[model samples]
Target chain A: MPPTSIKSRFGSRIRSLRDDRGFSQEELAERAGLHRNYVGGVERGERNIALENIVKLAKALSIPTRDLFTDFP
Target chain B: MPPTSIKSRFGSRIRSLRDDRGFSQEELAERAGLHRNYVGGVERGERNIALENIVKLAKALSIPTRDLFTDFP
Candidate 1:
């Protein structure tokens, strides 16, 4: 599979987790101290998000960083 | 704690995993299709490595991506 596939999967995982937490994109962005547009892009699989950002998002979502990779094939 | 601390811990984790696998920095970089310098920077906690690269490294190490975050505190 192409590299982007992994990104897309990761993005989807983030989106689903955000949804589970009932966090809107803006809410998640604020919690993670990121731009809303950036969070939206991540949800859409348009960004190759860095590890720091991943940690930020995981912290905002109150989940372990490894949770972000859960269910990934 | 500073954000760099997380990066530093992550770098140490990667470095230890690489060592455990008996892979040199150059070998791991080549396997992950990354630059040796980039891998070195990551191992030294100087790089905010992106998800694609993280996936590459995990694959190179023959471990699930979640394993990269193992023992992360």
Candidate 2:
């Protein structure tokens, strides 16, 4: 298994889920009212987003935040 | 509240619980068959230790792993 950071795991999970829904980073960011760069950083596991931002992302993406990371492989 | 990474929360909780038990970082690492530096790294939120290692730490500390991070403030 790849050595994964806590944020990276969450980010990877988010990317996987967003990809699963066929949503682009730009689209998801727009929906979440976050910057595209910020979304990309989040997806790449390069940022430590706030829990509030997480809630916003979850709400915009229509997925529970836990669901984004709980089942990561 | 300050933004936290997942592992930091876990590590802080571990430190708290270990302190609760009057155990030093070296003591806990020895109990868990982990290096003292590794334990320090985990405590400082600077490393992404494996799930297996987490399990070992939990077992050695005699606390459920979820208790380390769940209900974090």
* Candidate 1: pairs in clash: none
Model 1: per-residue lDDT, tens digit, A1-73?
A: 5455877888899899999989899999999999999999998889999998999998999988988897654
Candidate 1 shows a clash count of 0
Report the CAPRI category for model 1.
medium
Give the per-residue lDDT digits (tens) of candidate 2, residues A1-73.
8788756876887788789889999999999999999989987878777545765687778965444445433
Docking class of 2: incorrect
What is the C-alpha interface RMSD of model 1?
1.3
Q: Across residues B1-73, which tens digit of lDDT does each residue of candidate 1 receive? A: 5454777888999999999999999999999999999999999999999998999999999998998997664
Q: DockQ numbers for every candidate?
A: 0.69, 0.07
The true-versus-predicted C-alpha distance at residue A56 of model 2, in Å, is 0.9
lDDT of 2 by residue, B1-73 (tens): 8888756766787788889999999999999999999999888877666545765777788865444445443
Clashing pairs in 2: none
